[model samples]
Target chain A: MAIRDDFEVVASQVRTVVQRFALGLLVIAAFGAMLVGKADTVLVEHARVLALDVVSPVLEAIARPVAYANRAIADLREFASLREENARLREENARLLAWQTAARRLENENEGLRSLARFREGPEASFITARLVGDSVSAYMRGALLNVGRRVGVAPGQAVVTGEGLAGRIAEVGENSSRVLFVTDVNSRLPVLVERTRERAILAGDNSPRLRLTLLPSIAGVQTGDRIITSGHGGSFPVGIPVGEVVETSDGSVRVRPFTDFSRLEFVRVVDYGVTGLVGTGAAAPAPATPPGGTAVRSR
Target chain B: MRVDGTLAILDRWGRAALPGTVLLFFVLLTLAPLRAPYLSDTLPLLPVLVVFQFSLAAPERLPGPLLLAMGILLDLLLGGPGAPVGVSALGFVLVRAAVMSNRRYLVGVPFLFQWAGFCILCWGFVALVWAFTTLWTWALIDPVPAILQYVVVVVIYPLIAPLLARVRARDPLNVPELSRGSARPGETTP
Candidate 1:
């Protein structure tokens, strides 16, 4: 009985001491965490990148099923709507056939004109097609991953496009997967021109839905509804590809409605133009002409 | 010696089977990508699972430290910011303790009442954390969708709860019985 009483007394005393120490520790920990939170944004971003690198493959593996299931559900819903869609498809098909024939005829005529005029040969480029794997739904960084990666010849800085127009470019490349920075990403910029007026401007995205056309001189002849296309000034992307249509906002700033709907992206083509030496060659050709012109101008 | 023996048994079972099965199911569900996008947009099911695990499982059966570790592992697997999970899980355990303290009142209450109470507490905690982090106003201010999602989860809770409960009850290692002893200071019946 005596021993039991002593044990109880000691236990109670120990508990009291431990509880007080724990309370003190908790207060210190809370303050420390707050300080760390304030001071560790860079560390946190680094940790996030490391974590993403580690988890990306697993997430991609998991995302495949989710994407598949979503597609399956969509297919089921489409089956229900198929009867209504068939009649529309028949009429659309007929109209498209006529347009296709006219397009073929024009293409043939353009080839004939090209052979006669001896137009300069554009850089030889090849392309590989890939399927989009996953994307972020949140508003901040709009990007997606594609199944094609280094193994499939996709490289960072390579341009990605769809049949409609420019989608984005490969930002990060893995062995079997690559992340594409969509034109809507805040960091994305493309040198574009107005197809109608040849006015050059920089298209920049600000995490907003619309892309802004910056660096436009006040007197530049650009109008609302003008078509924007690549100018081929930069070797990164080929010129003459349709980008988007221009729209003048209420604030008098111009924005382009991107041709590709990022949310619905599925398939894309990665162009491997093999034009790394073309820029140097073009620069060298201009130099030879410059020396002759300089001597002639001096003699005059 | 008795506690060591019990822990040995739990270690064997935990290592041999339980965690693997749990992990496998989680992976399968993730792979099945069984997503109700519309449902998830409004009500996240993963947080509800976390809350449920805290409430129904005995604390001694799953120590706070172990729970935190599991939560972190889950965060890594789920590919999100990792530390929020550890913090959220600790919060869940604290709330569970508060609720379980009034077991007499809660036990006698209808299952629906219990679920509603549990969801309200969970949502309140989640909203508070989200607000503290300066998330968009739409996250916390829009209560209609939040409540609707909460209700959907609560409605489905009964179906999922029993399965997990059965798994806990049928655990061959008897970790639950041993853990219950250390749950409270006065408890001595293992």
Candidate 2:
């Protein structure tokens, strides 16, 4: 028994030693991967998308019940004011009918005007529909994981929106997934124009629910509850996408409340405008130019 | 339940499983997209607390390898463009290293000191991450969000600590086999 006890002690010590060595190796490997990822983010992105694709099914299965429960709770809240909601919807329908009639008349006039002006149109836009599968939106990081990615032609800098209005832009793309950086992310900024006044300003995110509007001309007229839309100055997002509405605050600090509630985001459309803006210009290339101050020469 | 005074020793796999499961659950919690207003920026430091509590009180189950894995996984899940990854792993290691140094004495310290220690560690970790992120991006990210997260984590720690203590208590497999004084891996004693 004494001999057996001594052998067990020795074996246990050996196991402990081996585990420590393995632990050290793993820590080193993990940190090494992190550094490599920092150096070349694409390497980590490939692995991330693969893992995301594998886990997407599991995450969806788990989220179903939570969505169901949330819907039920929301239903309960709405049920309490069903009559008020019906009246509100009726009023909105009436207003929309009037707007629709006006929009048709304006559309006819705009087409005539464009034809007279002979405007040049760019390539048509397409969209990729993706579900909001994961909410990795934290204070420090304001991005959500989408279920569709490169497999479906999703790419970085694509504009993501919901039925309500503009939501955010795709910041990174993976093979089977992507990350959408919400407009409220501190790192986000987009040029916007107020609808009523047509005044242009900068919409800046501070990781808050309300985005700030800055750089408006001192003479620009601003009002609370005014609509805002993308100015499309950078040629990334297409022009005139509804962004948000001006917020009411007593401090005279301008803020716009996003139309889409990010906390409750479930799905979004990723739009491909096909204009990368990387190329110097879209104008037709100049005809083969002669050598400066010299006649063109034949080359071998 | 015990038949007499003898505790039931967990099998090898069983002994290694619970802490991992718990830590993983916390990781999932960290990644879960909660839909509350202002929640995106102030998720309680659940993963950090798990590492701190388990590393301090239940190192037998949560060794260095598991902590490292948890950290790496968190880094992947929590990062995007302009976001720092690997900070979570670094933070977890920092806390684990701190705990390992004085774990024997810390194993049974009053809850207050543990809470205090966790707050300090969290603040330091946040600062380190913010600094690292600045250097990586060559720009200064607004520190307001990180500071707010630290505040939220500190405020919620007291309420969450008791439940974590209960979890640590349930992991009594780490308890010594006092009766035999040298129980083997598979053996059970008082």
Best by TM-score: 2
User: After superposing the true interface residues, what Cα RMSD does each candidate give?
Assistant: 9.7, 6.6
Q: Is the docking of candidate 1 incorrect, acceptable, medium or high quality?
A: incorrect
The prediction achieving the highest lDDT against the true structure is 2
Local accuracy of candidate 1 as per-residue lDDT tens digits, B86-122: 3333444455554555444343346676666667666
Tens-digit lDDT track for model 1 on A31-101? 34434434553343344344335545665676677777778888999999998899999999999999999
Candidate 1, TM-score of its B chain = 0.56
Local accuracy of candidate 2 as per-residue lDDT tens digits, A1-300: 999999999999999987667546655665675677666655666655665666666666656676677778789999999999999999999999999999999999999999999988766888888877777766566778888877888766677989988888876666777778788876666778888888777887777789988777742377788999987665657788899988763455688899988877787999888864431111111114422211111110
C-alpha positional error of residue A276 in candidate 1 after TM-score superposition, expressed in Å: 9.4
Which residue ranges in model 1 land beyond 4 Å of their true spot?
A1-72, A80-84, A97-123, A139-141, A184-235, A240-266, A273-300, B1-52, B55-190
Kindly list the per-residue Cα lDDT of model 2 for residues B29-67, writing each as its tens digit: 665666655554565367887777777656667766677
Give the residue spans of candidate 2 off by over 4 A: A1-34, A116-121, A197-201, A214-219, A248-254, A277-300, B1-11, B37-40, B158-190
- Evaluated on CA atoms against the true complex, candidate 2 attains a DockQ of 0.31
In model 1 chain A, where is the ten-residue run with the lowest total lDDT? A291-300
